[model samples]
Target: MRKYMVTAILVVFAVVTIGTYYVQASQETPPNYKLTTVQGDASLVEGIAVYGNYMIKDSTFGIKRAYITTNGTDYPDEKSAISQSLNRRPMKTQLDQWIEEHRQFMRGKTNTSGFYENEEMLAYVNATVDTKRSNDSSAKRNAKLSISVLNKQKNNTLEITSDINVDHDISDMYVQNVQLIDQQLVAMVFMNHSASGFVSEPQIIRVNLTTKEIKNEPLALPGVKSVAADGDTQYAWLANQNLEHTDQWILRISRNNHRKAYQVDVKTGQISPLTFQGHEMLLNNIMNAYGQKIYFLQKAVSSKENIGFAVISYDLVSKEYETTLKNTHIDLSENITYAFKQDHLYIMGYKNFKGNRLYVFNLTSGNLEYEGKVISTEAANQAEDEANMDLNFIDLGQF
Candidate 1:
């Protein structure tokens, strides 16, 4: 009888342990997404903006150009649209004349070093004609904020100009990210801490272009790095760390009620805790892109030498965590990156090396698609070395 009782106890314990293991494993293993890959000529592409059938690539020369191929092998031409629009010049200027005009505009802006800062400083002016008006109704619009009109066709450029009366002090506000919400331009600005080496406190400001007013809101986290807004839902995600420690938190705010700010949505806002063991994670540099779904990137803490990337997607309607990409194959060594138009993400490291390849998760197929290789410092140096050796080689008389 004693032996039988002992045997029965052991069996039950083993069954319980196995069940626990299975539960833990199931939680960790997320469903895979479909992925695909395409190969092309090795061109370092950055800041991909897709509008209609055209894709614009912003390169090192501070110029934005697009490429299209009638035949698969050839991408032969480039044009300067961003430069022309910024200068208030006619987009149809002859090639040589446009080049000279862009050169002059760039020279004046040469002293600016910070990428985001320079872009924010440029004045944006646009003009549009209202055919419905009895007269050839043309109105000029101008503002200190960056503006782009997304029309049905998406390619036509409308013209507008106004001697934008910007409060020069607005430039003093360190604007981090800007987004268009409900046909109104919303900007997130914080304190500039690059020179100080540390951020003590951060602030968030929202500007209503239609009202021409600015509202400043205080952040709950001390070392707030970045802020992103979900225009569709009127919720803002602010990523920041504690002033004394490295712990990070994602604070969600309701734009509708600017007065009440909470860590998570009690009625509606949601907060998630993110931790980085030793390395300092700049919450500001982290990016969030929206489409049919909302996706954001956070650093994963692991015991392994190489801590990989973590991607989280939240379903707006369900109000639950839809999917997570944790410690995946995506490279995390690079400091800054952006999510591409096709829901693909890309990151470029210093000196432009092939740090890691980008793959998109296809929700329907449950697999990952190989998008393309991200330029990193390591890959760039290797390519340079090979090219230099080829140039230095002396041809043998006979091989």
Candidate 2:
């Protein structure tokens, strides 16, 4: 009888202990885990987002955002968005870095392409329309383009405003780009029909900085016709980077079932078609042009029928293949995220159980330059739960 009483008392004690632990666990929870760079140059992983579909508890999942950087990760949250607070630095976790770098000279910026900055100078373009309404009867509007330039080394500002040379209505025109080549300011724009709501092709406006004289230059695509309103043909003029220093712009004409890239000498007003040596390149595959070469991201397949991916660099002058970046180091089995900037390519391989790995390549040299990985900083006990975590790598943050 005494043994039976002892067994019953022990059972009651076990129940009470479990209930107390459960209450404590429910009251306190740990912070969310973040992904950090394990090894290699942390600069390779900077400015990219590690989107996590993390396993919260048991089979449940939660979404989390963390900005990867070399110094440390910044998890942007509600608290990190308060600007005027006492702790401003801790709260200033914005995604884009463009405004932070060019905010000083970005006044009168009408569009994204209206701003351009280099080591020596900063340039901006603004378009405005002055309307004189005669009792609102189809108001007369005058289009004006303003150029603001700041020379960093000389520490001086030059401002010029010119009336856009357009015979028709330009009230609906917008600035496409603003680039500086020595003393000339180039403003590319598109005019929309106010009545039909149609967007026309890109037009170039040249401003002689020294003379403050403005002139108009047309896009010279000799025989290529525009796509009609009700046609199946889709057309676009691909604008690219490095226009300020290159003294020329690579203009790509893309149409339905056809693609042709052109090298327009901005200074001399010369237009020529860029040649592709072997297989024809599709418009969507053309990444961007830098210097005298164009890059393409195309898929490749081997004799064994194994699928592969390729990044090709074509020399515009020679009309030949310069470099093809296909290395054995890159994982061919999983999905990859890539970004092309200047002469560098940033690639990230997706790994489900193992953390995602980063790969950086030099496009000019066609070499795999650096490698890094994404690691979890969660508790060791949560290893099983973390296996369900899904990380999707978006492109590198735009500068």
Candidate 3:
């Protein structure tokens, strides 16, 4: 009887311990969503914009107009669009041929080294002669300063033209960065050529669609390269870090009044330096959405080849550093790229060179999971070619 009682007690204790362990593990694990790459191309993805199921990616080849697919079928064929305010002129047959030749030259034999490696050559070529080409001239003339939205379900495209129309003859200014805030398209324009022989400062401009007017808001920093805003706090964060070095600063600007700008500090600042492991960290990007939260990526200050990336989130209400997304084992060098939409944080990463993968993490659930890779490089290349065929279909004269 004594032996049986002891055995029963041991079994009960074991069961209790196992149950406790499982409960703790479940509580600790965050809920994560799955994101499939669906498609990608090797033509140097310049920018990515996400809206509902529609995703627009701009590349050297052209713009890839695609929609998110959950169960394999594309949403629908969405029409490509350009700015409505843009007055497109009829291109002479000679000019059309010239544009085609230039496009082929850019896509084909031109050295990729010109883009990434040699800045001087790229600057000189793109500035002086390339600007005279038909496509380049059209881009300059149109200056499509607003965001273009494609409705996949309806197979329609909507171009939101910039409210501010300035006839200042600003020829070389290119749209460097764009973000959607409360249905308004905010754009950053910078001079294409670096006159300072180092880096150029970008001008922050905001356009109100309802008012149809443009506001020229120069950034507080003279050499500011990028700007990210937290809508909840009505604060805009600008980074002036050179990619080659870690010397950088984040300026907090009041959205209500662009003139009111200050550096982030311990008391009033939303950012915390403690979240980053490295002293030499440079801010790369910032993403903020309503009720979703704001997150930013910082590259290590050091020049070490193996240094990892850090993701920092800030609480808008408390103005405090909330969490640090750090996993040293995960190599995020070229492996990670993120996009924020609604309540979803889409983190696309690859574990190895053989395959491209994507992971979707829910900020609210704290859940992280691998979604799987949808499109391979070879497949992406084919899709890009198909999209380029429609380039001739659009009547530029209607612009």
Candidate 4:
């Protein structure tokens, strides 16, 4: 009877321990998003273009690779590539001739894909600033920001139907990124006066697609590194780097780059700064602007060299941020590429010397959704060894 009692007690204790272990495991388990990935080109890739669920990437030597959300190969056929080539080539326009005559006008640059497509229309912003110096140390600067629209025909041809240019008084003007927000073409404009001696400020300009009217609101801070918006909730991260003074800049370059993040009000054009913990926020991994939170990867090291990153969240309502994941043992390369879709943030980078790896995180749960290897080839490895290798985001939506 004594032996039997002892055996029964042991069984009960074992059952309790097992139950506790399983409960903890279930609570800590990550979500299953059914994520999958396939091989892209073995050569280096430049940028990515997305058409709904499908993605198009320009591989080495003009080779294009198209894939869906699953990351499987679905190359765009010859006809589609040929059609896009027309847009890719430099089309000689009056703007090009104007740029040639005026060297200052050439300084005002625009993105290659200032054109963004939605609802069968391609919209772009073309900007040029003219600077005329007076005899005394003063100068007169004038800028023109133009909004152009091209209609897509049933035959996949784009024809320019309308163009309207907005006149503004600014020393230098450039269109950084144009986004279609709330049925309007909103452009993130970088403008400054030459006397100011730096990029003065970042402006949010909204264009009425139908009426060709333009209205703008300026951000409080200069050096806007990145900006993302979703409906009314918008935010911009500022990275104040003096490209002129590389040495003094390098003193605080890594730490000062993303030192501040701000919540932007689309209606009022007002910006309020947010307090966050880490400093080295990776600008490339910033996902699309969600409702009231910004999701991004930040790397904070004890010294100047640690490259490990931590995931963090900034709440637009509270205007504060808390680190969701502590710095992991995983080391990340400076060349990181990322994209956000659904509720997942997908990232790719060199996992130390283990070659390039792709990872995804659940923005809602703050759990790592998936991590896998992106097959690297010999040529890609050689190219990456070069000094100028860079990781470019293939603007999934902008193309």
**TM-score of structure candidate 4:** 0.48
**Candidate 4 structure quality by residue, lDDT tens digits, 1-399:** 999999999999999888875565445311111113434332222223221111112222122333322232233332366676644321234334434643342343345435455556555676666554444433344456666655545423222223223223345566655666565676656554334223234677788765656776655553342222222222232221111111100001111233344455544455554444454333444433454556666654333455467666666567577666554554554556666654456565522423434555667776765554433123443333321222233233321
| Per-residue C-alpha lDDT of model 3 across residues 232-260, encoded as one tens digit per residue | 22333333221111112234333333322
Q: How does each model score on TM-score?
A: 0.34, 0.70, 0.35, 0.48
* Alpha-carbon shift of residue 330 in model 4 (angstroms): 1.9
Per-residue lDDT value at 114 in model 1: 12
Estimate every model's Cα lDDT from 0 to 1: 0.33, 0.58, 0.36, 0.45
lDDT winner between 2 and 4, please give it. Answer: 2
Model 2 agreement with the true structure over 196-311: per-residue lDDT tens digits: 22324456788888899888776756544432343334244544553234665666655445677677776766788764545564445746777777788764434333345677
* TM-score of predicted structure 1: 0.34
Clashing pairs in 2: none
Backbone clashes (count) for model 1: 27
What lDDT is reached at residue 367 by model 4? 72
Q: What is the lDDT of residue 196 in candidate 3?
A: 19
What residue runs in model 3 are displaced by over 4 Å at the alpha carbon? 1-171, 175-188, 193-199, 204-215, 222-293, 298-310, 328-335, 348-356, 373-399
**lDDT score, candidate 3, position 81:** 43
Index of the highest-lDDT prediction: 2
Which runs of model 4 end up more than 4 angstroms from their true locations? 1-121, 131-138, 150-171, 177-185, 194-196, 209-211, 216-259, 276-289, 300-308, 318-327, 333-343, 348-352, 374-399
